[model samples]
Target chain A: MIDLPHSDGGHLSLTVKVWRQDDADSPGAFQTYKIDDINPEMSFLEMLDCLNEQLIQEDKEPIAFDHDCREGICGTCGVMINGMAHGPLPNTTTCQLRMRQFKNGDTLVLEPWRAKGFPIVRDLVCDRSAFDRIQQAGGYISVGVGSAPDANSVAVPKKIADAAMNSAACIGCGACVASCKNAAAHLFTAAKVSHLSLLPQGSAERKDRARKMVAQMDEEGFGACSNTNECQAACPANIKVTDIARLNREYAYASLGTSD
Target chain B: MGALRRLLMSSIGKKYVMGLSGLLLIGFVATHLAGNLLIFSGSEAYNTYAAKLHDLGALLYLAEAGLLALFVVHVLYAYWLVAENRASRGDEGYEIGYRSKQRTTYLNLAPRSWMAISGTIVLGFLIWHLIDMRFGLRDNVDPTFERYVDEGLQSEDGRPLFLRYERAIQILQTPVSFVLYAVGSILLGFHLSHGASSWFRSVGLETHGLGGPLKKLGVILAVVIGLGFASIPIYVWVAGVEVGDLSAAEARERARHVSEQALNQPVEAMTAEDVAPAGSPDSDAGD
Candidate 1:
């Protein structure tokens, strides 16, 4: 990740309201931190680093947060800022959110992604491993990579590949969970269903994948989709709600044990 | 009997009860409005119309009883269905259930889902309506049927209470009441927009060539009901005329002032982020 140079003497100050929780099943509360002289060009994560450094200097426990790769691809840096997922920029991840985007004296309200499945871990951090568990339930191809047939030999249709790519665009950020009125994981589950269901190699386990993923999704205490589409708007990848409808159809058909 | 029991227990069946009872209540409103409009022709016409209904005797009583049963069934079913839906959703913030078995699939139609949300809002407005108009001040007749039947009048301290029409006019003359009625009617319009057509589809009435006409009828009914209900407050506001014996011009001015205030009130915009507070218990903090 490129660290842009700070302009105008590297001085930026703002108030941040962050959610703090010690562990799962523990009560949480908001803690306000007054950050001063922050670098305007620094990414949102880097700004958090500056605050943590100050805390460490003061001999206090630094705020715990999550980030990996400092790139948008990892989907690890998820935060709700001033009521929006990944700050104000549409389709932008928190890692890409720069301090320059915010003005001086602006109050930033930060929180973890709210959902029944995602329990609070600590300050600004959540246990998104529920998503990982759901994915592990049936989100992969059973075919061996080395012994696999050639790409062209499989003969995938252009439309199928395009659809698969759309589903594959999902980074599993859980914005859908935070945005949804029911905190449903339909978008994530549907994207996974559509991704593998569209591909030829994954067809063998298609029914099992749908069943297992949906069952696991429910087991995680995620709400059912009332088709609010807030998830679609909040999604960084802009995953269509149509994919959710497709997931419903797939589940319905799969439950009947028929492809048609 | 078993099939009837199943129908009563199902979600669609509860919706059917609501629709059917709603239609019945709409019919009552149309008849009541037609009767009330006679007041413009003078008290004799209005009183005679009331007397004619009273003269029906046992038949009128039976009809009243039937309407009461319908209202009870509608209210009970609505409460039960909403409770069931809430229970099914559990702790989840929202619930999206499969409606594949239902004849008219909301999955295929975008507007249908929008209507469902609007319907919930309208339902809320209706509850307030029943409290305000039916059970509260509008029913000038005492809750006890004995006083209404014996004297053929609204009783107050052992005397025949005059100015039944005046009481209604006073209630309607309030700006807050007028605005509430207007807003409530608008919600009703939205409810009927989706509901009218869905009702026919529910009962299998939209078959063959009847679908087009039935849909048109639905739209017409929605508009007519919305306008009919809205006109009560609008007429009082526009005419600025007091009914019966209440001739308080000051009250009329006060009503107009309130109406203006209600009209001028600014509507607050609700954004997604504004719904839940930052770092609140419900909000997710990225860990």
Candidate 2:
């Protein structure tokens, strides 16, 4: 006898079209899976789990996808659903997208994030390590944690604090990369610049931060921001293009005398 | 140095040129639109207005020279900025994200950045306009003196001038021109919709105390300018004047003759000679 409950459910049936790839550079195809008797309260990722469970019962190979920190903070779970990053909910991450948002008999299309710099790993999984490389290029402050002066030493204005907080909200999601026509990473780089450059802690390395981040962004094969502002719309974090503009200003100033 | 370096090396300079030249061009558009609106007053009034501008002589020459310089600088600086931006990003593409949460709550909900796309379309329409009206139609100037002359104007000599109002009427009467004008006008409206607001923001005129009112004013100005400019071609086409059937070459020859007649007329006859020059050297002098 099947241990799974047949129906605790309000009626919801969904058809999911998921991309399946064995490895990077490998050919990929879409596989259809039917999910039935889903609860309205369950999250969209939960719905995927239900499908995966059914597939496992049949001894079929389970689909591979990325997710961690089911809450929205990690930026780990990003997938394009029906041509939109993070599904239909504006500024809501994939894990936060609840099945209650959809009606019965809905069809969901899922695919890995698309960008020249972000290659697919397997199935719906993609290698987002490019963002890491770019971050490492100089996303952080140079000051050692304990080596820094007293926090009260620098008197940062309230407006700067608010702006820095805004920039600090970026979660490093690659939705911006997937949505952009040019696949520009300006939004991401901008967030990094704004967060650090706005804070007193990050003042010493401000110029280097802008220069290194932009250089790393270019090296990663991302495109330039055309000021389309689409990425600003798709971001779950709701990061602004103003941050990008600030980044541009910082980069401009840095390039004047910097050797690199 | 490369184009990128050249542009960056003179970033502030380019911005000054863009801002100044852009303001000057805006003034020209305003004056040009005001003059064209007189067409609604019947052919005689409009024609006289055209003749007046022609009689300005030295003043008119100065205005044209200023407009030409503004146009050249604006185009050059625009191209330079675009090229430098592209180079800075290099081959790698930039990522853009929609900050739907923040924008909806914190910032103005309107997708104002979409104006760039609208501006590009308007630019294409402007090119078509130059070709059709300025070059192909040769409607703006009387062929006689090479001075800018409005069609349907009388020669300062009091001789009955053969204006190309017939051609203007016929061109406007065509379904193609009417449709083109309508579509172009809509694009222009969209371009101006965001442009007026952006211009204020660029110049640091959008302060918290005045930003809201300024934006509202910008919208009103955009709508007025867009509709006003767009209405000219539309009104001419719809007026249904009985244009005698003239071949394209015949039309050109006739326009040329009318232009010569208007140009040779004495400086005293044109009302434009009486007015002060349209622009001030002191305005753009800061750049």
Candidate 3:
């Protein structure tokens, strides 16, 4: 007997409308799928895997999606389910989103992140290399460790370390971009800027890092922040707009030619 | 010049300009509302304020020039910023627009996505207001106000002389001007509902416990300014307080009474010229 999470001991059927695009240049459309016999215990990704397996059995092309560890740490898997980033589960990745939130007869619409900087690669996958380019631009500390240091060599204040750790939790997922009204990269960029600028080790290049990264972000065709905090609301990492405030502080000081 | 160029070219630098300009404009509107509210005190107080402002001559013009410059800078930068932002979002938007988590949705929310549309309406209304209220050769004005202009107690130099309180009340009660001002104030309220608080965050003023309170403050401020400004027109229209109903003669009587009270003269002893205001220029054109 098959397992079911319902009292009826029957299958859960769902109507899923998934975006299908051939490549970056090709136009895309929504293709509907009628999925039945789904176990309510399956994660959202597992449900997608079941559908892909069914497609393979029918001699059709399996849908392409990006994921590494199904545990949601790699920041690889993401999709818009019913217009919400990461499938309507607040601060939870798509891989971790349980199918229980949805009912059996529900219809889900899945699409990739939409932004000029993020063009669709195939179905439910877009190029986020723009983020890497921004990170490389200056979202780094120039100081070298020269091997391991003693435990007491660096003593970060508890308050400051807590702030840094909070901002450093950003997973570079494009949810911030996906849910932003302007598709701006303020949250992601601010997270990196705040994480490094809060620490003593990153003080040397802090000013230039803020300046270069902001410039690179603008160059990548990302929009400006209107400060709606939509990104903060949609983020899986729970990154706050206070981090953006810190980035603004850093950018202002950098523009003013101030040193640490 | 190099430093100025860098400030203008960068995204954050432009935002700093936007925030500063927007805040200054808020200051202007607040003071303007204070002065405009003097109409409730009766004709004499309002006219004295207007006459004194007009007599400031060059200093008043200088302040007006500065305000216009701020407005121009705010509008121009907004234009460029919006254009670049639209270009970045690509030709296609999400079939569904942005919606955030509703936990903090108890906060007074303005449609942050509709800033450009609301701002455009406010701009149009401002231009129409200048034409309707400031410039002469207009329609449906207070009869005594037309006499003041003819008597050279006021000039047609675009200075609004609320010499008779009816001058303001009458204009507000007009069919077109009333709707225009009402819509303008409402859209300005919409703009400020989100923008009033967002400017600080743009300028990096966020701290612990500040965001929520500032958002609440923005909503309160917007309601007071926008709805408060719109209410006067609504009041006049509803009251049907028109000018032709003993208004012109009443303006004259009030002017005479005010001047006599200031000079402490008897009604029988007071001359006709005593009704002319101290700050008002004598007749250059006769009615």
Candidate 4:
């Protein structure tokens, strides 16, 4: 990923309101912090690191947030910036958001994803193990371990191939859940369904995949889709709500065609 | 049946219910609107359509029962969904300075956020409509409306058919009823606009090629149904077409005159054009 310069001008100073919680059982509140001389080139996560550095120097507990890969692909790092999932820049992840997006003296509010399904673990961090459980429910094909098959053997049409690839792009980011009005994980679950269901090899388990994943998603206590399309807007991977539609179609067909 | 229960009970399963039921209701609206449009064709045309429905006896009742069941299912599931969604959203909201900057295709919130309110408004309107129009239970009764309901289309003694067209015209001409119908029509339109696109999404048809057209179709259907129904009341009020407490023969003559004048043709010409199956009328015009 290209690191864009903060600006042609100078460094930006920002005031951030961040949610602070000791643990899952504790009630969280917003804490204010003023960080000065923030370079425009630094990513949003990098800006958070600067504040954390200052907290450590003062012998105070540093603010906690989640991040694994600084790149957008990992889907580990996410925060609701100014009420938007993954910050204000559309389709951009938190780690990919540069300070250049905000002007100096900007006051930004950052908070953990508030959802019944995604309980907050600590400051700006939530337990996302729900996604793993939902994924474990289906989200995969049972192929015997063997040498890779020839690429031509699949014989997927270009349109289907492109669709499958697009659906496969979802990184299981909780941004969809954060942005959704119901905190619904339909978009995320649908992406997994579409990715595999469209592939010829995954056809054997396609019916069960949709049913089991949906059952698991519901079990995780996510809300139903009202089709606000906010999930699509907030998704950093650019996954569309159409994947959800595909999941619905697949589920209906599966339920009708097979007892499983 | 167990599988059906599992599907309907789950989150996504409940969505499938919303999508399918919503589409069913949309179909009902389009058909209902078509039947309403028959008012312009005059009494004989409209009454013949209503008569055919009434004449079906048990089949008509069965269809009505099915429709009522659909309405109950749709509204109950929708209410349940709204509650579930609210619960999932949690109690905490963003701070005062927080604002959403995400780009969206449509700027209007009526179709997105006003769903519950719009749905409630439409539901209220539906109850009032059934009472006033279907059951003939309103106070200060137009006795002519009661006659239409009691007698099946026409009297056995060769009296003219008490055409539904007249009651429709009379009710629409009243100021309060007209306003209510107009508002109800518009609110139902808003509901349909969101509902149409949403149904497809709920069913998981989020493919790129189809989503845009589906969204557009939803808006178009909403406009057509909303404005089309509103046009009737507006037409009645503006034109000052009075169908005041007429005798059976007089009502028939009035119906024939309007139908002939409007189309410059006989009622048979229009009825001949209606190719709907025996009992359903123009319901199957399109999905």
Candidate 5:
């Protein structure tokens, strides 16, 4: 047999089962496609681009997915890869995932975030405006409109600052909701709530923020936290479930009519 | 009062209720298991405990009402929450299990996910337990046990003590009740494995250092409770070799049969010759 350049382990064949839906009202199902001679060095999104190109040449409707920045930062790229949020790697975004991680002849299943709070927009895109609404409900600290205060004006302990920053690392990608069995958004809401509340700047309305955001989250039809911690496992930011515990404390205080 | 209503109605509030009520139920189950363990202590002890409970009269009725209210609230709230949670994932769930799974379609195969199924089994077991043990329905419990009467074996209030033990043995000895109770106890353990520890997290009692250890402890408690209750029916089946609480001759016969069983012989088929005749080949020589 004649030797081909594919002998370098640079090529792989894969079967992809991707969810396809035209619009919000349409029912979706997994459509399987076989791709050959893939470059393993390609990012997962680039592999998808190859699949779309192949589909175009085959006179079929190409798959629809969302991506921006082609990096892990934007949080624009996300889908359930074999039911895992942001593919199989821990602390990874879909755009940052390389095709080399998967083996040849492996089958991968992809789907949009499945939750009432993040309804499907198309093939692999879902509406995450519920997060925006929750943020609007309270997830912000109000500041007086003037020249910014000096950086050292408010004394924040180094440890507390680090904690706040850690909580603030959440990208609001909706993976936590997709990964949750209950489709609960507790992680996303809790991250924001914790990020603000841990800092003194957010103490003025900390309790109020917790109550309002949680109420909005409930109104969005997201389910309650069952303390499963699948959201913690699935988060790309590696946010802890302790943030959720903190939110619980804040809400309790607020409901008990604590004036701060 | 208005705040209370809203707290009970909100998502976190509803979770608080579920966890609080669930912990309360766990308490009741532990107490019940403790009481049930007195069965091994013989008629006088078990009956004395039962009589003490009965003597409470008005206090017992009041406690029972509270238990019933808690049960009703816990069950109804659970069903409603399940429905609500199921809907939150939209009409369709994930078509495949995640990376660690073997391509199964069910999205979650974790122990916590199966809580409802285990809970349902526990409910069935509870009803059966009440019917056979508490109410002593003639159809459900073997009425044959009522005939195993003895003289002068009465509680402080003259309630027949031997009949209670015999009645329990009669009921638990059957294949149906045995399977029901045994399976129910195991499944209840499975349910509590998740529910017991999760209540801590739900009510905000879980902390970083304590959460992991708390989980292991909860599972251990759950498993122990399960095995403890199941042991009773197993004891009945073992002690049931003779007619439970019967003539002394039958007890002697049972002891002889047990000794023969240790030799692995069919008790009836074993003539004296079959059991190591001097000239016969030693079948158990190596052992």
Candidate 6:
């Protein structure tokens, strides 16, 4: 007998219309899955896990989805729930989304990020290596870590340090890509460029970072920023488009005659 | 250089090109509006202003050519950006997210979606405007600046005395032309209101603190300039002011009124004859 616990909150019944793709090249379709007796406090991924367990018992193909560090910190878990990246709740990730937010008999449609730059790997999983390549292009500084410097020695101003940390909060989830009409990676690129570029250690490579990261982003077939601002709206980390302005300023200065 | 080309090919670089070109076109429009506002001043002042521009000879043509080039760059790049944005959306759209009627705040949160439509209508109006006035295709009256200068305040055999002023009033009085001008100006207003500051933001020039003020300035400028152009056809049609029939005294009175209203600067009363000739030392002297 399966144990079912009914907590303070009532159990939720959900109908999920989820995209099912065997591989990147295979034709994909949506498969409907009905789940019942799910605790309202269960996270969105937990509900998915319950569905997968039932599928395993029935001797059918379980849904394939990506998740790591069920907490929101890792940025590994993301899916478009009802056409919104990480569901309708703003500034919340999929792993953090509780089932209580939805009512009974609510139908949810889930899909992977659908930008040309992000190729679908399997059901609910797209190859996000494009973002990694953009990061590797020039998202960091080449400062040689000879010896550990005292934290008080290279003291950054509180304001700049705060901005840097804020930008550093980007989890590299492709929500911005999924939400953008143009699928522009400007917000994501701006985050990485602004994060390290705001610090003293990252300042030395500021120009090169903006130029190279932006170039890589464009090369990856990402679209340009049309000022729609949906990326900022959908951002789970609440990263502002102000970083984009800073990136633009840095790029303009770099485009002029170079120092070396 | 390859670097410049590469920069232009980049998305942000293309935005800089659009921003710079848009600003250049706005400057030309401002100058054009100021000059056109002279129509309210009566024949002598209007014709004199038109004639002086003609006297610039090759300089005037150079400026015109530069303006045309700027227009081409702005329009072509705007089309490119729209096409690129379309391709980025992939094969399908969201089934539920970002519903059209949903309101995010008190102010409408949706970015103005009709910018491309408004821009295209304005572009079409521009071509029609050139065909109507510059080519003199409508009434077969010569609208050339040199011709206006030659016939200033002088009655030709069986023709209007104030050639340039008469032609302007006649064109403004036409119903079709008036409606087209009115609609075009409104569309242009919509285009400019969003575009002026948006270009800056797209290029990353607009900072957080300055965004609100910059947007306000853009909308204000758009309304002022759009209404300013639209007013010419409306005032002409309503007042039924005969440009060629005004006597010298009436002309002087109107010129003073135009200076006070349009320029917002009071000037000493001066007859048409009192005005210094073009290229005179006082006229050429830099302020």
DockQ of each: 0.02, 0.12, 0.45, 0.43, 0.29, 0.30
Q: Give the alpha carbon lDDT tens digit for every residue of B1-287 in model 1.
A: 65455444433345556667767776775676677666556433443454345446589879979987886786676566555444433332211222121234345353344554566666677676666544454444232222322333322123222222444455667777789777777667656655666555443233335655766787787788777777777887888856543223322222222222322211122234433356643233211
Give the CA lDDT, 0 to 100, for residue B56 in model 2: 77
How do the predictions measure up, each by TM-score? 0.58, 0.70, 0.88, 0.85, 0.85, 0.80
Q: What local lDDT does model 3 show for residue B263? A: 29
lDDT measured at residue A226 in model 2 versus the true structure, 0 to 100: 46
Kept native contacts, as fractions per model, are 0.01, 0.04, 0.53, 0.72, 0.57, 0.43
Per-residue accuracy of model 5 over A85-186 as CA lDDT, tens digit each: 887777788988788778888888999989998888999999999999999999887855357678888789998898889889998898889888789999
lDDT of each: 0.64, 0.66, 0.77, 0.79, 0.78, 0.76
- From the highest lDDT down, the ranking of the candidates is 4, 5, 3, 6, 2, 1
- Across A1-260, the per-residue lDDT of candidate 6 in tens digits comes to 11222344778788999899899889888889898898888999999999999889989798888899988888988988877788767788899988877877778898888888888899999899999999999987686745779768888889888999999999999899988877889899999998988898888888888888989988998887766566777788988888887877777766765731
lDDT of 2 at A147: 63
**lDDT for position A110 in model 5:** 90
Q: What are the per-residue Cα lDDT tens digits for candidate 1 across A1-260?
A: 11223345446888987777787667777788899988788899999999899889989788888899787888888887766677666677888988987777777788777666787788778788889888998898775645757658889999889988988999998877776545778889889998998888787788778767877876787765544355776777867766775666566455555432
**C-alpha DockQ for predicted model 5:** 0.29
Return the number of clashes found in candidate 2: 31
Clashing pairs in 3: none
User: Considering lDDT, which of the candidate structures 3 and 4 is the better prediction for this target?
Assistant: 4
* Sort by DockQ, top down from the best: 3, 4, 6, 5, 2, 1
In the range A1-260, model 2's lDDT, one tens digit per residue, is 11212323466998988888899867788888898888888887888898999999999888888889989999999888776688777788999988877777777788888776787798878788989998898888767646656777778888888888888899998888777655778788888888988886787788788777777776677765544466877889988766765776676566665532
Model 1 residue A88 CA deviation (Å) reads 1.1
Q: What DockQ was computed for model 6? A: 0.30
**Each model's total of backbone clashes:** 14, 31, 0, 9, 0, 0
The per-residue C-alpha lDDT of model 4 at residue B32 equals: 91
Q: Model 6 residue B236 lDDT?
A: 86
Winning candidate number (lDDT): 4
